[model samples]
Target: MRQVDRHPGKAEIPAGELWLVVDSGVKKWACLSCPGGCGVQISLSLNPEHRPRWKVEQDFWRRPTISPSIHQQKMCRCHFWIRKGQIEWCKI
Candidate 1:
């Protein structure tokens, strides 16, 4: 996981399948690569003004957890949540 001001900035968006990119602190955006290995990047908005946004919480383990689930309407059709630094996929 990497904290960046801009996507693909100094960071390469780690090649790890489950890599995360946090932009402008934890409130700007939380991005991740699609688990489908389709080389697509997913961006979750944290801006309150945005119609659909996600919230990130920290567990006792300091692991990042995302709520309300992530559903991709396009392409791979992946749906899941990140809890305790793990991806818990929901039935698509």
Candidate 2:
């Protein structure tokens, strides 16, 4: 995952790279393309006040691990976990 001052454009984020939107030194959003190969854009909230907020942690290698699995309820309906910058798809 990479930190960006603002939200990145759709094409700006390369495969397997997540953009962590940090404005004023505060993490605000986590954006990435759907790992389900559905060509969907996923933006998860990092705000504590918001429902379904996700927390991000980084290892010494700068690999990111997000708490709670990402579950897409729309088109793809893909469910997965990101641990150590790797995608672990749920068996459903």
Candidate 3:
């Protein structure tokens, strides 16, 4: 997904777009839609001091790679990984 440097809105973002919220030059959050097609918004914390935080790396092409995996406890409950701007679904 394309990483955008901005705050996440209360509404749903466009497909294939991820928001990287930066506050005062510090990366704070990563927001995106559920790749499972559930249309749920997922916000990940980027702060190192947070309990549940994910590391976001972008290649020179602007493709995003998120460390570990994303598991939605509610809604679709889809677990997946974002690597090189592609979604890799985890086996159930």
Candidate 4:
């Protein structure tokens, strides 16, 4: 996935029909979809104190992209995916 800065204009990141990575740190979550386009949201907390969970409904969708692939999409470095529990340590 391409990394992007989390500025005022850049908040939401859509991860195709697979998943959408949201937020950072131990309490991270990704919005997923079933094969038939059914929404299946799941969250995973890398920290032991936190719990890995799943949500049925999420706010993730396919955003308009100039290019087809996510790699070709323009994004800020801060908007990329960081390790589940190590997001705080990530640097742009």
Candidate 5:
């Protein structure tokens, strides 16, 4: 799992995976790779509300077509971005 700068407490929950966290309602809840361009969705369940806290639809990946960064050079499809921690899917 990797922690993103924007969301210091939140980490990439991994593709096709789900994670649950209990928040104190002071901080924001979000899915790491969703809005950034990854074709993944994240749903959160909060105590007063049972709605999706963050959701990234698969179609989001088709539009805007964000390119990989220089750090991802020569990496395979399975490789992806993780700002805070190492990626289990990709190892150098």
Candidate 6:
């Protein structure tokens, strides 16, 4: 998927897509349609107040670079990481 800095509500983000929602220039959070075919909206904070948050960076190509990893403790329980615009699944 591609990266966008738009106000989340204004964009028609696709399913299983990654969206970077920000306020002004500060990244507020990252969101995506759950990749496990659950169709649930998974949102992770980039704010310092939330623990175990993630970060995102984008290159000129518009692809995204996400850091650390993402682990869903809830439904589907998917675990993976996005690095340099590629999703790397964790063998969990």
Q: Report the poorest 10 consecutive residues by lDDT, candidate 5.
A: 63-72
Better of 5 and 6 by lDDT: 6
1-92 in candidate 6: lDDT tens per residue?
A: 54467646645457757877767778888888766666566677888777878778778886777777888767888888877667788995
Segments in model 3 whose C-alpha atoms lie over 4 Å from true places:
1-6
Residues 1-92 of candidate 3: C-alpha lDDT, one tens digit per residue: 54456766777877788888887778888898887788888999999999799999999998899987999777999999999989999998
Measured against the true structure, the TM-scores of the candidates, in listed sequence, are 0.75, 0.91, 0.89, 0.24, 0.24, 0.76
Two-way TM-score contest, 1 vs 6, winner: 6
TM-score (C-alpha) between model 5 and the true structure? 0.24
Candidate 5 per-residue lDDT over residues 1-92, each given as its tens digit: 22223333444466533233324533233343343344444433223353433322123333211112112222233344332232233355
The per-prediction CA RMSD against the true structure, in angstroms, equals: 3.1, 1.3, 1.7, 15.4, 13.2, 2.9
Candidate closer to the true structure by lDDT (higher is better), 1 or 2? 2
Give me the runs in candidate 2 sitting further than 4 Å from their true place: 9-12
Report lDDT per candidate.
0.68, 0.89, 0.85, 0.28, 0.33, 0.73
Off by over 4 Å in 6: 1-13
Candidate 4 is scored at a TM of 0.24
lDDT value for model 3: 0.85
Give the clashing residue pairs of candidate 3, or none: none
Return the lDDT, model 3, position 67.
Answer: 87
- lDDT tens per residue, model 1, 9-86: 334344433334455454577777776556567778777788698887777876878887988767888888788888
Model 6, TM vs. native: 0.76
- Pairs in clash, predicted candidate 1: none
